[model samples]
Target chain A: MIEVKNLIKEFEGRVVLDDISANFQKGAVNMIIGKSGSGKSVFLKCLVGLIRPTSGEIRYGGRNFLAMKNREMKRLRRDMGMLFQGSALFDSKTVLENVMFPLDVFSRKNQRERRKRAEFCLERVNLLDAADLFPSEISGGMMKRVAIARAIALNPKYLFCDEPNSGLDPKTSQMIDELIQDITRDFNMTSLVVSHDMNSVMNIGDYILFLNEGIKEWEGSKEHIMDSDNDKLNDFVFASDLFKKIKEADAIITGNEANEENRKKLIQRMEEEAKDL
Target chain B: MTITGSLENIGEYALLMKRVLTPPDRMREFFREFFKEMYKLGVNSIWIVVIISFFIGAVIVMQIALNVASPLLPRFTVGAVSREIILLEFSSTIMCLILSGKVGSNVATEIGTMRITEQVDALEIMGINSANYLILPKITAFVAFMPVLVIFSMFLGLYGGYVICYLTGTPPVSTYVYGIQAFFRESFVWYSIIKSMIFGFIIASVAAYYGYSVRGGALDVGRASTDSVVINSILILMTDLVFTQLAMG
Candidate 1:
């Protein structure tokens, strides 16, 4: 489990992450969703030690991540794996070499052992045929798969993915979502994903944290987001006509339009955003 | 930028050096990278060095021989002057300035591109010291190979002079050969070799500093690469002046 308490980050007198507290459970995909410039990336970077928060307590497995010594942080980073939005595979390395990188650096395995492990990771990602191919030789979805294979090569205790579905088509996005969910369950690793894709959120979000302009506006499951009373969350989330129609159809069928008044208010807010744009 | 900002950058550069100089996390991987870098940074550069030094040496000989047109001066003066020019300055200082443009810009663009593309961040996220993993091998490989390049330049340069004397026959080949062997100081060769090694370090490290400091997109990477070459040239000249003064002043 991971815990963040009273986390605050400011840049040049502008607050980016307000005093925020949250917990991410082990073996479940915890999702952080927000509009752009809403501090989702900053919050994720802080958790990964890429950015230092202004003030906070970040505990990973009962250890104070914020206050660990350099050596300790180095040791702990081995247990963390991150998948970048751009896939960030080493352009110079072939697919198999990319997976074997962390193992070569940190594991005491022999040559055959390391190669075998990297091959296993590629096989798991169904990318064994592409082992000899460089990242540039692959498609966007295939690159993301390679990134996933490399990320899980170490069997990290925590897996963090930033916008893993940003540039892919719907079918590939769904496949990636299922893959993330399957790995989290099979490895029982604490997974934290930052995305704005409602398809992913509704399909795989076991837990969700919603940030609106750097503050936690709501936190719950996908079902809860549909009925959430927060005007900003509703306006931003259901801005798509498809999700709104689904919500309306569900209300009509279940006679659970207890928040029908809330829906009208959200429509009004969406209209206001459109006018401003 | 203000003085405070410049000082902050210097501090950051120093800290980055510390990170880069740390021991590798794994020996096998370090050696693998080291050998690859030796080939990339050192072996790949042999042809350019050979071509430039050979032609320049021929030019220096012809220029000096044409200018010493008086019977009052000895016939060997052209060869002696060419030797001094190549050994004392050209092969070491000027050649390195040329290489700074070739190799320095390369290191900067490669690393800066990696920075903007998030490859360096990936290394850091993997618990690898990106500086140590990426820059150290290049630095060591270049530093190790620079003296050999300088030696090659020295011999090739002298041979070019020999060819010029043999072909032109203005100064007799025997006279030029004697002049080449005259006043040949072992210390001058050592000095040039050592200076070239230092130049190698400056070229690699300063380029790396510029690359690692990059934060923007492709345009920023281009700026960094150009900036690295400019700074490397300036630093190489400045260090050359100091080294020459120490050795001959």
Candidate 2:
């Protein structure tokens, strides 16, 4: 589990992340969702130590992550895996070599053992045939899979993905989302994903933290997201026509009559739930 | 760039060098990358170095012979002038200037692209020292192979001069050979070698500093590559002047 307390990040006097606090549960797919420049990326970078927080405390599995020394941080980082939006595979290396790189750096295994482990990782990602191929030759979805394989190559205890499905088509995005969910559960690792894709949010966000203009606008599970009343979050989550219709249908099913007074009351109840949750 | 910006860049470059010189996390992998870089930086550069050095030698011989039209001057002076110029300056300094364009831009572009693509961040996430992993091998390769290239350049340069002298028959083969062998101080060779090694280090490290610190996207990578080549050339020339002053003052 990762716990963030009063996390604030500023850039040259401009606040990118306001005082926000949240917990990412272990063995679950936790998501940070926001619009462009809403501080989701900033929050993710801070969590991963890519960017230092202006002020905050980050505890990883009960240890003070922010106060750890460089060597201690590096030791912790070995158990952490990150997948970038672009997949971030070494273009010069083959898929097999990419997966085996972490092992080469950290593992005491011999050449044959490393090869076997790499092959196993590729097989796990259903990329066994692409083991010899370079990243440039693969499709975007395949590249994500290769990135996933490489991330799990060391059997990391934490997985962080930044916009895992950015350029992918809907079907591929859904597939990638499910893959992340499945891996999180199977490996029992804390998986934190930064994404704006509503499809991913609704599908795989076991826990979601929504930010708007650098502030925590809402926080809840996917099941409760639809019921959220925060106007900022509602504007974002129900911005689509399909979701707006769903909200109308849900209002009717819940026997609220879709009246102004009752609708306002429902939103009020949701706001309360947002605070309590 | 402003004075403050230049100073910041220098400070950052120094910090990057400090990180790069640290002991690598995995020696086996480091050596593997070192060997690969050796092939890329050294073996792949031989033909271009040879071709350029040969032409430079031939040109120096032809130009020197043209200028000394008076019969009062000995023809062997052409051989001596060409030999001194090629050994002391052309093979080390000029060859490095050429490589600053060739190898420096390549190193910068490669690392810059990786930076933009987030491959460097991925390495860091894996608990690897990205600077050491990405740069130390190239530095090692440059330091190891550049001297060999300079030596080869000197040999080919002398051969080119000999060919031109033989073809012109003005200095004659025996007189040119005698001139080349005359007053040959071993210290000049040492100076040339030291200069080449320093040039190689400057090219690799300066290019890498620009490349690894690049931000933004593909355009930034291109800009970094250009910056790397320009900066490397300026630094190499400056270092050449300083080394010459210090070594042969």
Q: Write the per-residue lDDT of candidate 2 for residues A63-170, one digit (tens) a residue.
A: 888999999999999999998999999998999999999999999989999999999989988999999999989999999999999999899999999999999999
Docking class of 2: medium
Badly placed stretches (over 4 Å) of model 2 are A252-255, A259-277
TM-scores for candidates 1 onward, in order: 0.95, 0.95
How many pairs of residues in model 2 come into backbone collision? 0
True lDDT of residue A252, candidate 1: 56
CA displacement after TM-score superposition, residue B63 of candidate 2 (Å)? 0.6
lDDT by residue for model 1 (A130-183), tens: 999999999999999899989998889999999999999999999999999999
Cα lDDT over the full model 2: 0.91
Residue pairs in candidate 2 whose N, alpha carbon or C atoms collide under 3 angstroms: none
DockQ of each: 0.83, 0.77
Task: List candidate 1 stretches off by more than 4 Å.
Answer: A256-277
Query: What is the TM-score of candidate 1?
Result: 0.95
